[model samples]
Target: MSAITAAEGNPQIEFWFEFASTYSYLAVMRIEAAAQAAGVDVVWKPFLLGPVFLSLGWNDSPFNIYPPKGRYMWRDLARLAARYGLPFRMPSQFPRNGLLAARVALVGVAEGWVAAFSRAAMLASFAEDRDIADDAVIGELLAALGLPAPEVLARAQAAENKQALRAQTERAAEIGLFGAPSFRVGEELFWGNDRLEDALAWARAGP
Candidate 1:
C-alpha cells in the first residue's frame, strides 16, 4: 500500500499561491520541475490574500504597509532569483490587481496549462514589470497558449467560476494559510520560497 500510494497517490502537495505575492513568484518558477523529479503530483491552488489580510485586520499588502519589511522583501527576492537563474524586476505597481489573472488561472488549471500560464503571468508582473491587472495582458497570454482569450475570459467571468475562486480562497483560510507560496503535504504545511525543497522532500517521503 505504501509503494502504491507513492506511485499512484493523490496530490502529494497542494500549492497555495497568490499572484501578488513575491515569494510565490519564486516558488512558481521552480515547483513544477522539482515536483516532477521527485515523482510527486502537485495540486495548484490559486487563492487571494486580500480576504486573508482583512481577516488579520490589514487593508493592504504587509510589504507596502510596512516599508522596512517591504525593502527586505525586494532585496531578498533579488538574491533568490539570482540564485535560481531567474530574472527579477520591481513592478511599477505593488500588488497589482490579480483578480482577472486568478480567474483565468482557474481555467488554466482545468485546461492543463496552469503551470505555464502561471509562470507567464508571474513573468509579466515581476520580471517584465507589466500590469497583469489589465485584461489585455491576460488575453495575450491566453492567445499565446493557443487558447481563445475571449472565450476563456468569458468562462472565467461566469458566476460559477467566480464562486469557485472564492471557495478556493475560503479553503485556503480553512487550511490555516496565512501567505502565498505555501505548500501542504498531507496535514503538514510549509511556507516561503526557501521551503520548496522541504515540501517536496516531505511529499516524496510520504506521510
Candidate 2:
C-alpha cells in the first residue's frame, strides 16, 4: 500500500538526492511519474552533500566554491524547472543545512512517507526559496504531509536516524556518487537529473 510498494517485483531504483542541490529538486519533482510509467519504483534516498564533499577535501558547496559552475547551475535549474512546469526560485542560502531534512527523510522512508516528504521539502527549499535548516520549515513540511510533526521531528533528532543518514551518505560516496539526483540500479551510478531516464531504462533492462 506504500508508494514504494508499487515497485515490488520490479527493479528498485535508488535515487540519491541532496536537499540543497537545485538539480536534485528537479529530479525529486518528476522522477515518480516517469518511473511509474516505466514500471519502476523509485527509492528516495536523501543524503547530505556536505559529508560527500568533505570526504573529497572540499569545504563548501561546489556552487559557491566554483563561480562559473554555480552561475551555470542556477540558469540550468531555471530552464529545467520551467520545462517540468514546476515553480523555480533559488533559495536565499546557496547551500542550506540539509542535516535535519535528510534525517526526516530517512524516517519518512521507513514510514512510507518518503515521496511526499521529499517533494514537499524540495518545493519548500527550491520553489519557495525557504531556508531548510530551520526546524520551523521542516516542521511545516511534515504537517503539510499529514505526518505527525512531533514524532517526525523527534526521529530527525534521534541518534539512530542521524547515524542512518550519515551511513547513507557514506554509502553514496563509496558508490562514487558526488552529486545530488544520482540514481543507481545495482552497482552502476548514474548522476544528474538528466540521467534519470537512462537510469530507469537501465532498471527496466535489469541491472
Candidate 3:
C-alpha cells in the first residue's frame, strides 16, 4: 500500500517527490494553488529517489551519467520555470544529498507544516542555491517556520524517524513509482511536473 493509502475516499492526491529532483522542485512550488483550484487535497510524500534508482541498476542519476540529458534537463527546467514565473537557478551540485531533508520533512508532515517546509527547502536549493545537505540550512528553515530547531532536528534524526522515512521510500517502490515528482490519484499514477494539473483533475474526479 502507498504511504498515503489512508487518504482514500477523499478528493486527495498523493504527491510523491524527492528534494533533489529538479522537476519536483517545480511541482512543489505551485502544487497548492493547482490543488486548490481543482478542489483536491494533496498529501505530500517525500521519499528518496537514490534507492529507487539503485533498484533500476543505476549507480547515479541518469542525468549526470548522460551529458546530453543533463543539458536538456537544465534547459527544459529554465524554460518551464520561466513559463511558471517561478525563480530557478541551476545548483552548483547536481542531484544533491537529500537524506537529512527527507527525514526532517517527515517531522514537518506530522507537525502540519510539511507544505511550507518542503517549499522552503526546494527554494533554498533551486532558487537560492543553498546547500540543503547542510544542517545549518535545514535549521534555518525550521526556525523560519517558528519551530525549535534543535528539538526538531533531534527528532528528525531519531532512529525511529529514519526508519519511518525508509519505510515511506520502500512503499513508494512497492507502489511502482519509478521517478520523482509523481502523483497518485487512487491507483492511477502521473509522472513529471507537467502532469501535476492532470493529477489534480484525477483527484477531483475520484477513482
Candidate 4:
C-alpha cells in the first residue's frame, strides 16, 4: 500500500504522523510518491501528540515552549520546503488542533482515501490557514472529497472512533514515539521527515 493502493506482498513501513506537526505536513505531501518510488507500502497512522507531550511532562509543543527552538524550526522548515520545491507558508496558528482531522483521517485510512484526504487536510492546516478543529472546516474537507460530510462526521464522532484514536495515541507512547512523521520498519523506528528515505530503504531491504 503506497499510502492509498494496497499492493500485497510488498515491503511496508508504518508512517505515524500527527496532523499538528510541521514536519508531518511536509511528509504527508510527499510520502505516497516516495514510497511508490522505493517500491514500499505505507501504513498511514494518525495519532495525537498531546498525551505524548503530557507523558514527557510538557503541556504544549516544545516549539511553543522554547522560543529559540521554535525560531530555528520555522527557519529550517522554510529552507527545506524551498529545497523540496513545495509551497512554504507560515501558518497563522502554531499547531492547530488536529484531533478531529486525525479522527477523519483514521476513517480515510480504512476507506482507502487516506493519502488524498491527508494531503488536502495538510494543505488546509499549513497553507490555507484553516482551523482544522472546526466541524465546518472538516465537513468542507470531506465534501471536497465527494464523501457525505454529515455521515462521515457522525461516524468519526462515534464513541468507538473516539476511543480508537485514544488507544492509538497510547500505543504511540507504548512504542516510544515522542514526535510525528515517524516511520516504523518492524521494531526499528526512524524519527523526523529527513529520515523518511532511510526508513523506506530499510523496508525495501527487508527486516
Worst window of 10 by summed lDDT in candidate 4: 1-10
TM-score to native of every candidate shown:
0.94, 0.94, 0.94, 0.94
Q: What is the lDDT of candidate 3?
A: 0.92
Summarize candidate 3's per-residue lDDT along 103-170 as a digit string, tens digits: 99999889989999999999999999999999999999999989999999999999999999999999
lDDT by residue (16-59, candidate 2, tens digit) is 99888888888988999999999887888999888889988889
The reply for model 2, stretches above 4 Å from the true place, is 1-8
**What value does the lDDT take at residue 113 in candidate 4?**
89
Rank all candidate structures by their TM-score, best first, as comma-separated numbers: 4, 1, 3, 2
Instruction: Residues 143-204, candidate 4: write the lDDT tens digits.
Output: 99999999988988999989999999999999999999899999999999999999999998
The C-alpha RMSD of each candidate to the native structure, in angstroms, is: 2.7, 2.5, 3.4, 2.8
What is the TM-score (0 to 1) of candidate 3? 0.94
Error of 1 at 95 (Å): 1.0
Candidate 1 Cα deviation (angstroms), residue 158: 0.7
In lDDT terms, how accurate is model 2?
A: 0.88
Error of 3 at 70 (Å): 1.0
Best by lDDT: 3
- Give the higher-lDDT candidate: 1 or 4: 4
